[model samples]
Target: MSTTERPRILVVGGGYVGLYAARRILKKMRYGEATVTVVDPRSYMTYQPFLPEAAAGSISPRHVVVPLRRVLPKAEVLTGRVTTINQDRKVATIAPLVGEAYELPFDYLVIAMGAVSRTFPIPGLAENGIGMKGVEEAIGLRNHVLEQLDKADSTTDEDVRRKALTFVFVGGGFAGAETIGEVEDMARDAAKYYNNVKREDMRFLLVDVADKILPEVGPKLGAYGKEHLEGRGVEVYLKTGMDSCVDGHVVLNNGLEVDSNTIVWTAGVKPNPALSRFGLPLGPRGHVDTGTTLQVQGTDYIWAAGDNAQVPDLVGRKNGNENAWCPPNAQHALRQAKILGDNVVSGMRGFPQKEYSHANKGAVAGLGLHKGVAMIVMGKMKIKLKGRLAWYMHRAYHGMAMPTFNRKIRVFADWTLAMFLKREVVSLGAMENPREEFYEAAKPAPAPAAPAGAGDKPKAKAS
Candidate 1:
């Protein structure tokens, strides 16, 4: 209860790790024993796996994100970014959304700032490409794609229509593949209502520099996914890199060229570069170097997990590969967060710290409605499935993994509604610039009758 002397746990970033870790810590802590504070740029933690569905309108955008304040009611959630962490002084410099920066002292720190989009210095990428990292981006992409359909539908020029209907997605990982599939399905459905637009008229391209797609599910399933997409009229170009997309003129390494108005980039993600300012020892690839205990190397009070930490994979180590690290994905993130919470509590109470370890379960991905691919690992058995059955498996697994019961019900409701009603093809593109019409109307009325009489009087006053 002491204001200045209470043990303070500072959680940086309110994404997956930050949210679950804080929740776990609070649950394990005795009444008012320690103070937990979470800080992030956004107020909600986005469930990234459902982002594609949100973009495709299978689920509402709001349901895909969990509000940090509402879920972590017992913890203090601050909307800000941790600019720098001074480990020696046990203080972190926090730059809030508004106001001057201040230092917050903490007894323990959790660095879960997560990853940002890993981008190359490709020309025009910054100006022309869109990302799918957040709920906002998903909704924006949905609107943009629909808006493009509107453009193509209304245009008479063949060149303009061609450019408008061409959609290019760079990267063939889970994100890129799932996104293109969902959005393409939505577009195909939307074409039914448009007079000029048809599914065949639209060009959907998936380009990746890698030789294969969906590498997480192994070669066999990956090949099946590639074949399935190609069968759906998608042009899957492997080992193809983008040369430049300047002004939407896509030039590919395979000597292919296309004019497209929409370019979606889901190449990869890198740990948040902000880790450097924290003064923690980072790996060569920029992730905070973490041991099997999920604690930062050489530091007892600082812990890290999720996409930002280079956590050792104990399972892999036991298999005789010592240098293997946990891949940055939802499965590991969720598990590491719970273990991290327990470790933090144990370390505080002088209890022994438990090392983090887990074997790979498998991977699953949904490709639009009634279509998916899955790989389940059961000891020596590896179960691979596709089509409607795999689609159900994907939903069951992720639906259960989604953070809270509230979200589980909402997501299931969205799916239930979809079964009876047709997919919502309407796009609220105006949501992005909702105030445009209002701003035009609210413009100050023309100089109220600064008529000839007022002008003559002003000239007389000049003397």
Candidate 2:
């Protein structure tokens, strides 16, 4: 905690940016020159691309996350939430998991907190709708889907069964598309074990405000994706808005009403709201305004990247427009963090910092097992693929891109093992409420038998 020691670089959020940024800084900086400290609420950085498979039980949840502490051994990893930043003082207020809030002073700061799911004033969204933002959500969705099956199979009541069998997804982007696909695949596999619940009996709906889905992949691939989903009996409602999900009754803008117990919301993500609390420049969408060099425009010591930073896309140049910013995705986040990290070292060493420039590498999305759509961009050539080949390409790219070597091998192994074994469909729903059984048992029950008395035996026999 001495002010005369090595300069401190404090990184907030341990997602794609924070993890790699610290790693790059640790690699570039000379010993005893600076110290890198990463702060995040969770110790691990989840490979979000595998979340759908995790939800589908295609991969183990434990393997999907890379522990930050284990990877960045040279950097100090603090598990905490950063409450406020006093840019003038170059200090961050951190609320650690175990102790009272304290201020952490630093010479440089990197804001990489990432984005949160964008929800609106929908009546029951906060209370009922499920989000697909983290590993917990993926696991919750899996358990909730399987629990629906349990309800449908056990209950004789037609209304309850109908309510439980219907599943609704609010967005048709990659997250929504892959999630519904995986869950539907899981439900289909699960039906084989159930006596009453048939796959045909269940209804899956994907609703979006846009006329087309997966715009990142060109129109042709998006249309193909829609057709593939529809062929599997999933309904696509486009150019329509969701009015309310109040009382679990989904009222659509087009006058369609459905009573579904499971509603997954992946509409979109907005920049973390905490960025606004800081006295910094923000773009139209509330993202921290950053220059092409990935540094806060007016500041020298502070840098930002990932979903929270509005970084201009220099690679996708147009007719004299050089300020087009990069989109918030794993592809850009990964590249941006590397540059951002290098730029920090460059600043410290008085070397020239380079601007971020990367062209759009199109998009790929897996509809389900052995089914997907991919659009890869190269110079003037655009490659479009679908079906099993596209699925393999999707897996191959993401699997190789999985953050750490430890995770990359495990994910590849999961895919390898999947070739021989059927996907898991069992629901560990009790995980959601892990203490429910303990609380039930702890409830003040009838006084314990008085030394296993004769009176207790007589009462038990009479009952």
- Per lDDT, the best of the predicted structures is 1
Model 2 C-alpha lDDT per residue in residues 291-319, reported as the tens digit of each score:
88998989988899999999987765553
How many backbone clashes does every candidate have? 0, 3
Superposed Cα deviation of residue 206, candidate 1 (Å): 0.5
* Cα deviation of 337, candidate 2, in Å: 1.1
**Candidate 2 vs. true structure, TM-score:** 0.95
Clashing pairs in 1: none
Taking the tens digit of each residue's C-alpha lDDT, what string does model 1 give over 1-463?
1245778999999999999999999999999889999999999999999999999999988888999989999888889999988888999888988999988889999999999999999898999999999999999999999999999999899999999999999999999999999999999999999999999999999999999999999999999999999999999999999989999999999999999999999998999999888789999999999988999999999999999999999888989998989999999999999999999999999998899999999999999999999999998799999999989998999889899889999999999999999988887989999999999999988766665666554445565
lDDT of each: 0.93, 0.90
lDDT measured at residue 372 in model 1 versus the true structure, 0 to 100: 94
Predictions: Cα RMSD each:
3.1, 4.8
Screening candidate 2 with a backbone cut-off below 3 angstroms (N, C-alpha, C), the clashing residue pairs are 312-325, 313-324, 313-325
